[model samples]
Target: MERRKVDVAVIGTGTAGMVAYKAARKHTDNLVVIEGERYGTTCARVGCMPSKLLIAAAEVAHQVAGADMFGIHAEHVSIDGKAVMARVRRERDRFVGGVLETVDGFPAEHRLQGMARFIDDHRLMVDEKLEVEAGRIVIATGSRPNVPDFLQVAGDRLLVNDSVFELENLPDSVAVFGPGIIGLELGQALSRLGVRVRMFGVSGNLGGIRDDAIRQYALETFNQEFPLDPSAQVNRVERTDKGVRVTFTDKPKGKSPSEVSEDFDYLLAATGRRANVDHLDIQNTGIELDERGTPIFDHYTLRCSKDHIFIAGDANKDVPLLHEATDEGRIAGDNAGRYPDIRSGMRRAPLSVVFTDPQIAVMGLTLDQVKERCKGYYGVGEVSFEDQGRSRVIGKNRGLLKVYGERGSGLFLGAEMFGPAAEHIGHLLAWAAQKHMTVTEMLDMPFYHPMIEEGVRTALRDLNYKLNIDPQMIDRALECGPGA
Candidate 1:
């Protein structure tokens, strides 16, 4: 076996691992990145980028199909699944090609194409061939779809998030088994593609956001937008002559509870995701992982027990979003080069988005989280998408945006939006919350007129109304000065 040494060895070339590798490279020329697969991580090839592109294509197809509603008559609107897959593949190659090219530019000895396992606290055995000793190590191996034991994926009857995109043909019917981000986004996209999609999950609807009002609005929107069977816990899935049959247990009374099954061409299991830590052999290292198998680290500095072995991304378990993973990767890279200090304590508020029609974007504390933690320190205000002019112009008058704040201090706790442009607006709220901006400051800020931003203005007005202040105080405060 070949033995090598480097200053930093980054395992996994996914989003988090790539960011850490790039940052660490600036600090030391002797850095090696080990990748288990041929391509980049999930964000680049599977999860975020390709999924969004697929959803965008579906959105356009749906709009063209509905063009008749706007007096634009069309005989027929059809989608070529092969073409869609081609575009998905082409775009994925274009995006990941750049990363691969960059990796090739690094020194020959700095990139390893193999699985890395821990040999000791400071050394790793790669593909049972090369032995690498590093001063610092970063675990950027992302996550994979969590498949329950009751369900078995046989051939192509069932699939997870990663394998679903490579589907050869669109299914006539699909029974989605979870309501997480992957489930909701893919379910909505497939439904728009004319698939008879039924979703089953433990929650009344999709979970994660904190505010009940927003959650309710999202659930209602999903129910209306797609044919979702909420609160359906699938007991098992089995292959049948016709196709696949999913059995449901504990259904509501009067409903068929005895092995009610649906025959579908395909089944998607998006229940949850588990950290990819099983192969790392952490026992060989002094590193400790959390209950969920995520590497345990100091929340402030993102440092694991051995200080030099840092973790980020989904592996850290603090925040799992791609952007959060990248941010944490940068912080970890910076801190790994130096001793931990108070400066590294600065943390940013994490933001997440669920891509459904009238997509959901949430940041900071949900109303329930605030109520549980601060006990009556929170206030909430909501406004409908119908109140926004842009929503009217776009013909999507469903969904709502709700803002939460402290009762006395009026500091922005967080905001949730279930409307057009919610993902974009959620980033603004995340920035404000991270900076501890007051509601007054956010309201006083000027937003363009006749846009989805009007929803933000209206939501702030509602919050001011709850505060017993004039709804027009926003306009008045804007007139005071930019600082208002």
Candidate 2:
């Protein structure tokens, strides 16, 4: 076995691992990044970039077909499923190229192209050949799409986001196994592409929004485009001559069929993803794992059981979004390089978004998180897109925005909203929450006329009223001196 020693070793060349390497490089060049697969980050290769490309194509097809609603006689807008998919892949490859180029630029000796397993606290074996001794290690292996055991027999009929994006053509119809963000985004996009789609959610919630109003609106809107049943629980899956069939139990109340036997050209099992830690040989590192088999790491510092070891990204089973992964990678890398006298960073306010039409967004603390943290005394308010002028003018009046605040102090706590450009709205609120801004402080800022951002103004206004706050402070313009 070849023996090597490095100051730091990073496993997995995905988003988290790559960021860890880049951040660690600032401290020392004595580091190596090991890869078990392709080098492109998840955002560039499969998760974000390609999925958005496909969604854009589907959106175009949907818009052209609905042009008649705008008093314009739109002609037949036939969809070229094959061409659309091909274009997405072509563009997606370009994004992946940048990531590959960056990885390739690293010193040849600093990159290890193989799977790595922990041998001990500070040692790893790469590809059953190289034994790497490191002062510290950062594990950022990311995750893989979770599919139940029985569902795998369907073979090619079963699709995950990774395989789904690589398809040369779209299937005629699909039965989505989860109505979460990934499922809803692709499910709606597929429907807009003229694919017959039926979606099954684990529970009543939609796209991770626990806010009752936003979740309900998301369900109602997505249901208008495709069939989505929130009460569905898939129990069995089998292959058939026509396509794949799925059996679901606990049908929704007052539904047509007592049992659901859904048949479609494809079965998308997007329930969620599982951490990719099984192959890491974590037991050798003496790290304690959570009930989910993920390593128990410090939330603030991203440190594992051993001071020199850290876990980040989906492998930790916490925040799996691209941006969160980047932050975590930086934190882990910084600590891994510095070691013993470790420095830690504060966790960012939580922000998650779903890229569907009238997108769903959750910013900072959720309602439940807020209730627990604030003792259920937070003031709440909401606004409907149907009641908003911009949404009405744009002819996309279908969403809801709800904001929460501290009762007396009226501090902006967090929000869950589903509306046009909810991603941007989510960002705006997350920034405010991070700065510990109050409702009056948020309102002091300018809100452009006839825009989706006005929705924030409305929600904040309503929240102030709930707190019985005098509208004079918010309604008045900013001035250096009072009554000047």
Candidate 3:
């Protein structure tokens, strides 16, 4: 077998693996990155960029449909599914091209295109053709859409994140199988794009929002966009000449859930994802694996069983967002570079956002996590978009925001919101939480008039009152700033 030695070897040239390679390059001149899939990262290829392209087309169609509400009437607002899909693929190919360019820039010998498996703690077999002997190895094999066994009957009609963007034409009707992030975003987008969409969610909360008020708002608002059943148990799928048929039953307790059948031109499975480690034969490397066959590693340092092995990205199942994957990869690379004297660093305060109208964004602690981790007193401050001036002005006043903080110290703990530009608000709360800033301190900051940020200030104000801090404290806190 062809054999080679390197200071570090990175598997899977996705975001995490690419970042790991770049990071390790700083500490060691000898490094290699291997992949057997398309070079572009998930975000650029399917998960984020292409989906957004579809969402963009959808949002335009929706806006045109809603134009009459503002006294601006629109006529003949028609869409060509083929044209819309062509633009999405065209733009998607451009993004993928950039990733390919980067991959091509790597040294010819350092880039290996083959499946890799651990032969031992210190060696790997690539494509059963070459042996890689390395001082350290980083695993960033990433993940794939979780398609269940039953859906296989649909065969070519089934669409997952990987295959959805490849559609040459938008289906006339779609039955989204999950009501989580992908389901809601694409389902709503598809419905707006003049497609009949029926969404299924096995849980009450859509878009994975845990806050009760926001979840309620999400449900009510989403219902207006598309039909949804949050309590569904998919029985099976059957192939048909036109497309496929799905059988499911409502699972709500005491409701006498009935079996329901639906036929659609396409089915999108946004169920979830599993780490791509099933083929790795990790047992040979002696790294402890979880039930999912994902390697168990230090969440902070990304180190695995041996000093030479590190796991990052979705492979570790710590944080799966693209940005977090990149950070985890950097941590893994840095640790592998340092070898036995590995260092550790904590991740940023949690930030998650789902791109939908009145988008859902969550930051820092959830109520459950707070109750379990912080035994100390905590309070929630909430506001409705109906009362917000900017939301009303924009004619989109429909959602809620809830901010949680320590009742005694008034320190900001976390926030969950379903409102316009909630993504920006989530970042603000995450930044404040990262600094351990309190309610009064957050309120001390300036809030512009007739802006969505005022909504955030309003929540902070409610929190200030809940903490029983004096109203005068705002002035005193503000006095420390310029022009006070």
- How high is each candidate's TM-score? 0.90, 0.94, 0.94
Output the worst ten-in-a-row residue range by lDDT, candidate 2: 475-484
Q: Give the residue spans of candidate 1 off by over 4 A.
A: 205-207, 249-259, 339-346, 468-484
* Structure candidate 2, residue pairs in collision: none
What candidate 2 gets wrong by more than 4 Å, as runs, is 233-235, 248-256, 468-484
List model 2 lDDT by residue over 1-484, tens digit each: 8999999999988888988998888888899999988888878987899989989998888888888878988889888889999999999999999999989999998999888899999999999999999998999999999987877878878899988987888889998877888888888899999999998876665788797766777777887888798876677788999889888774455875566677899988888899999988888878988888889999889998887899988889998999889999999988887777688876787899888998888997788877886586678888888878888887778889889886655677789888888888899999988877778899899999999789899989999888744445323312211111
Candidate 1: global Cα-lDDT? Answer: 0.77
Residue pairs with colliding backbones in model 1 are none
TM-score of 1: 0.90
Q: Is candidate 1 or candidate 2 better by lDDT?
A: 2
Displacement of residue 27 (Cα, Å) in model 2 is 1.8
Write the residue-wise lDDT of candidate 3 on 106-172 in tens digits: 8887799999998999899999999999999999999888887877788889999889888888889
**Which 10 consecutive positions of candidate 3 have the poorest summed lDDT?**
475-484
